[model samples]
Target: MNVDFVDSAAVQDLLDRASGVRTEGGDARIKAITRDLIEAVMRAIVKYDIDESEFWRAITFFQNGAPEFGLIAPGVGIEHFLDLYMDAKDADAGLTGGTPRTIEGPLYVEGAPLVEGEVNLTDDADDTGTLIMNGSVRGPDGEPVGNAIVHVWHANSKGFYSHFDPTGEQTPFNNRRRIRVDSDGRYSFRSRMPNGYSVPPGGATDRLMSTLGRHGNRPAHVHFFIEAPGYRTLTTQINFGDDPFAADDFAFGTREGLLPVPNRQGDSASIAFDFRLQRATTEKDEGFSSRTRATA
Candidate 1:
């Protein structure tokens, strides 16, 4: 038997009151969005025939570990969809070109020490193979765009990021650097190669991935935040073409132009990839978004 109170006047009244449709105390935009979301949830509940036990179990899952929802978002492509949506909007506005933007996978930390031209992202004693990355920031027209800030971060050899490593061995901002582009827009760094990693074992993301017939694995990759005055800030990353998950990234972070093959030599590898920026038409386009981020 099917239940159908989703369209009932009683349910609609309840939703209106619950969403604060009559209240003008808070942000009007937030209220409207909330109301619409609540309605959508109700519709889904009916469409999927979600039973009470299943719904309560989901509630309990969040109650136990809400932070896992952040991981789950990227694991299920919600984060990537946002980047794609923005790209579509840009295309509609005839704003295309430059490095493709991708999800900023909830791992970035603020306040890395600024450096001039070049820096070493790894300590001398680490036995991991060296990664030499040389690159320049250029405009869409191929001219060097100096005065840019390149914030870079990546996982270690074991695919664990600083400040988030459960092993408790990484120092603050390890393998992270903020390199200021020189007058020629050139920046380089030598670091250890990062490996691909799976999600926390048996955790929320893993559990959902299992049920959805998917895996929560990401390729070995490097992240970058490139911003220059008067140019749109680029949030993008490059995936190693050799990684098994490079093309099948769970977060959907890999793009066609962002995958670079590593050129290997004895005990070291090098990758050459230049970044491009586009002129900003408005001040808002020159800055990062206001998403909640970690700062240290």
Candidate 2:
């Protein structure tokens, strides 16, 4: 007893009108994309026979999930899909190689204190859990990109990031730093070993994840935004290969080249990795994305 009226002229006209097909205002690209999205939604409503109760409940979930919507998008794999889509486009355009790009989670804050030499990512970290990570940045031809700026951030040992942590125990830029590479294209930092964290219990994202039979946990990881002159800015992160959830990241941040094993010795750990950047053809490729990010 499924009623299928999606192909009817009446429904088609409604979709066109909503996209403002007959109007003289609005951008054409936006209208076209909006129309397609609405059409898909309409089809889903009819195909699944979604009841008013279910529909309104979904709406209510989002209405109260303003703080979590951004996180939810990544948790559900949409953000990762964007990365994969862009990767395909780049490959098609003969633009490949260098460090792989991954989704930049929503926790990055602008204007971190820049340091000259070996930087300490966390100022008050204990010696027992100190992590010393070193890396070298090189261009595609294997030469050093000594002028690069390595932007790094990660959660504290308790798996809570500053600014976004609900407990408010962390100070501004508690585990964030902007380290300049040395003349040899090397950068190093000392930080507290970050912990794997989960979503807020009983929140909108958690509830939806539970409904989908998925766990909301990200492995111990560190984010990076590396940019140098004449090179494309790289947005990537490294997941500790030893973490249990490293391969099953909820944010889909883990990738082949980005997972590095941390060597634990005594009370501290050490890790090292190298990065390679693709040459930038335009000035836009050498800068960070204009996407809105947090500031502290």
Candidate 3:
């Protein structure tokens, strides 16, 4: 029997062979995940009757656009999907009554300059809309959680992030900083309102999105990575409700109770919100922070 074409049996045999290749340690976790993913992909190809040329084209696209995959995750809703999964696990473990966790976009950079209680994120001469965001960190029991570090970062007026922009390397951590809460768990910062941005034009992500009849545009928002001792880190964002794309975010990040109503006065605006953190029960969770834990 000469079987030259790729079929169910042939796919399974190939997958089995590929799964057998591993390091000297023979990591069970990686091997298992690889095998499972192979099976899923094989099933998709067979079910969809995906042609060889189309599949190879997709492979090429992914290979060239590997870096942009992080930015693409939100558009595909993978970040929100994981948030729902984590919420379910927390509920099962009796974790509740805290600030909601949201998607942490791909632009986070570690080692932002630390400040005591307040800092100005934008350059003094830069003219974007002035905004003052104030908040307090509290435990789930409603007690203040002092000394918590609130790392904040956002895009500039032109919808460009500090480290990811073309000239970003020069100013490395511009528009990004870390502020520790006061003794009463209060934290505040001065920054200009950031605007929404689209996927990089002429990039692999933009090309794929164009083919799909979709636009990769996120709403204006501020990113926050809050971490305190004795609590799990919370990675979230504050979406600006006034943006035209606020309710129609391509990333699906906008959610109920997450958008704050700003108070406008003269040239400055203010938003007051509170964050409640859940207690960490394990040693691994003790030093938890929203660093590289997120997939996207």
Candidate 4:
């Protein structure tokens, strides 16, 4: 059967009506995207000799399987569309440059204890080694952002995050905290150094890494998420100053400015770091909601 003879004009009419019907407030952008997608499909059909069956197959694959694939697309840069848009807006408004933003991993949980000055994050462990992380949350102009809320979390000595470990206790999320910076914009915490850990080892992410001949070992580092009223939220990691893989994090999140200097002595160590945050200009730049209390 000659499906092309069914009329391209009628197909286009149906697409146009579908786009109009799906439109809503703030949907002018969506309509434009829909028009572009339809135009691209029409062009592909004509230029690439894509038959009706092939076109329908592509649509079916996207409809049935794309959502699951989309969840992991951010790891490969496809999810940067929103970040790119925000970056452009920030550049236009002169709200640029402090520390580059990175993707938040799947392990962030909220509602750890709110400690005063510092808390030994590894209090349960028997290791006597102490790590003190102190930093000032500064704005783009180099001014301190006082009273900022800084959330810190990391894998324990065994490279396992709380809530994700099946053998762990079910209390408030483990190895996490919401520390408020003092008037001097300084906050500190104590936690034992973490050891490197591999990825899930058999999951889809691990499968891809194996095919690429890569190891999924993440180096020892502490995770920090800082948010203040007028400052843009910062999600970053502080790499152990002397870890072997400090220069090459599995997640590729290592930045020159993020590595702090470690002060190590007999069974004790401390690290001091200063964090700089960008000023938030719009409401869209506000920090995300906390998920710490939701952990089982």
Model 2: clashing residue pairs?
none
Cα lDDT of model 2 by residue, 102-160, tens digit: 98998999999999687888865433488899989999999999999999999987788
**How high is the CA lDDT of each candidate model?**
0.88, 0.89, 0.79, 0.68
Reference-based lDDT, residue 129, model 2? 84
Task: Please identify which of the two predictions, 2 or 3, would achieve the higher TM-score against the true structure.
Answer: 2
Q: What order do candidates take by lDDT, descending?
A: 2, 1, 3, 4
Query: For residue 71, what is the lDDT in candidate 4?
Result: 28
lDDT of 4 by residue, 1-296 (tens): 34463247887777777677355565787887887787666666776778889889766755664433422344344444545666687789777687655545667675677776766565455344566677688887888888788888877767777777645642345567788888888888777666667766565545555766665666677878888888778876777757777775556655667676578886567787888888776665666745233344
lDDT of 1 by residue, 1-296 (tens): 23367678898889878988887698888888998898888888888889999999988877775777668888888989999899999999999899999888888889988887568887524567889999899998998988999999999988888878898888879888899989999999989877788888988888888889999999989999999999999999999998899989988999989999899886578999899999999999999999888786
Model 4 residue runs over 4 Å out of place are: 1-89, 126-128, 169-171, 266-268, 289-296
Off by over 4 Å in 1: 1-4
Best by lDDT: 2
How many clashing residue pairs, candidate 4?
A: 4
Q: By descending TM-score, how would the candidates be arranged?
A: 2, 1, 3, 4
RMSD of each: 1.6, 1.4, 3.7, 5.5
Deviating ranges (above 4 Å) for candidate 2: 1-4, 125-128
RMSD of 1: 1.6
Residue 230 error, candidate 3, Å: 0.4
User: Candidate 1 has which clashing residue pairs, if any?
Assistant: none
